[model samples]
Target: MLIHRIFQVVTVIDCVVGMMASGFIVSVGSTDWMRRRKLPACDRILICLCSSRLLLQGTILHATLFPELTQWNVVRGHSVLLVLASTACLWFAACLSVFYCLKIATFTQPCFLLMKLRISAMVPQLLLGSALISLVSSLPFLWVDYSSHLCNSTRSHLKNISFESPTGNNISYFKGFVMYVTWAVVPLLFFIASSTLLIASLWKHIKQMRQNATGFKDSKTEAHITAIKSLISFLMLYICSFIAEILLGIPSCQAMSRWKHNICSLLIAVCPSVHSILLVLLNVRLKLAVKSILLYMKCHRKQDSAEALWQERKSMSSS
Candidate 1:
């Protein structure tokens, strides 16, 4: 148990660092790059997603540090809303990937169809999808209380976690299974399948375009590939998380086991960090923004040193 607590502490620290990095990336990357590009506003959407993810990470981190909140107690109603918001962000990101893939692949038929749909129409759909999933996933929590030791909606508690019926008035098992299917299994499948197909389609298109010596603009193709790689990285992170979740759910698996906990804890942090890397490494506008931020930092440091020197001279004169 002491070892488990230590692991949780480490995981929390990592999550905090990742969240901070993501915040910086979003502030610097979104306004500087996404807004400038006049692209379909995907990067800003991702920034919002990452921010929600960061909030989820913080909730988990607080739970790990305090430990007394238990599974059912840790995530409040608003936390559930944030989690649902995160899911919405992720779905929007998947849509962003699909839009990007179509944009790059020059699938004129589908592109025309997609263009006919307004961004406003799409936002409500994604939000509704997220809301339904959250509602279903959280149904089990309504039966349990803050004191229950069982893994309610959030999968944190193990020993004191209530699995059996509390008052025999509730269907805990049924609800738990629903939560898993709605939140984990189904969403995981969609994330994996959609991202995989998008990548494959982009790959084929890029190869065909290359072979045909098609008049497809080279710079545009390269930009599409960059976005593709970033999306692939995001999807792969989700896949890792899905696998970790499955491993954690196995009956034979020890809930407090180091490996299960470690992987699960790490995913909480790693997912957002991957987004930060993509923004800085893949997007040219983000890279420039980072460069500008660095330059500003250097200049600020130099000014601080100059101020210190002036203060020292003034002190010497007073002496």
Candidate 2:
């Protein structure tokens, strides 16, 4: 019981931090859009990605931390909605990866050049298409008979398990498998493909620069390194999240100790939030914005302390 409580506290902290980072992205992007009356393509994508992640993290916290409240039929019916938010977050992040690859990678091929030229114009359309795809993919979940397999052997052993059984009827299993593949596996493939291409392009560029006697101590080289690091970090987190999700769905995992289940849930919740913080760190403008906000808060705090001290001194003298 103590271990379970510790895990729950850790999960809550992870969710809170993730929500704050994602919320920062949304706030900064929206503020910029409002001031300029237009948002860059990348900022637009960031906004969508952060918004989706925020919603996803919020729902995950509510569902995980308070399973009893979510057990109502009406709340359970909205399982598809949670799936929709998660799908959107995954697709948007994948889209952002592709956007970075197209924008930053230098490819001399006509097709690659053409895509680089047109990607800005295509961002809105791509986002819309992703949204439509997420919606379509999630809709099938609504038709899934969640109540049909309530007495499944795996779930019977678990306390407060929310996911429907994927080992039930042949039809339900097939649908669940399809949904899992489309929602999780496909987006991961896209992210991996984009990250690979970006890394290859950056490596080739770095090599050519090195051959030209330009040592690798320049801003562009540093940027390339940062981007590569960011991609690697995101991939690592995504893999962890993927494995956790898979394990959570397994019957064996359902029978695990409460602390083990809590740890799995914590990993699942960490992915979106941590990835958003990485995004902020990798992006120059976002990094600057976060720094500025922190500096402002620090200065304000000092000013408040100074004022309090002055008031105390003045009161002591008068007395």
Worst 10 residues of 2 by lDDT: 150-159
- lDDT tens digits by residue: candidate 1, 192-263: 665666677678777878798956688766776787788778777766755654555444334636566666
lDDT by residue (tens digit), candidate 2, 1-319: 6877787788888889999999998999999999999999989988998888777778777776775553435444456666778778778878888988998888789998999999999999989988998878777665554543332334462223664444342335346645756577888899999999999999998888788865447787788888889888988887888787666544343334465567778998888788888888888899999889899999999999999999999999999
Score every model by TM-score. 0.74, 0.86
The segments of candidate 2 whose C-alpha lies over 4 angstroms from its true place after superposition are 70-78, 147-174, 251-260
Distance (Å) between predicted and true CA of 36, model 1? 9.8
| Number of clashing pairs per prediction, in order | 4, 0
Deviation in Å, model 2, residue 122 alpha carbon: 0.7
What is residue 146's positional error in candidate 2, in angstroms?
A: 2.9
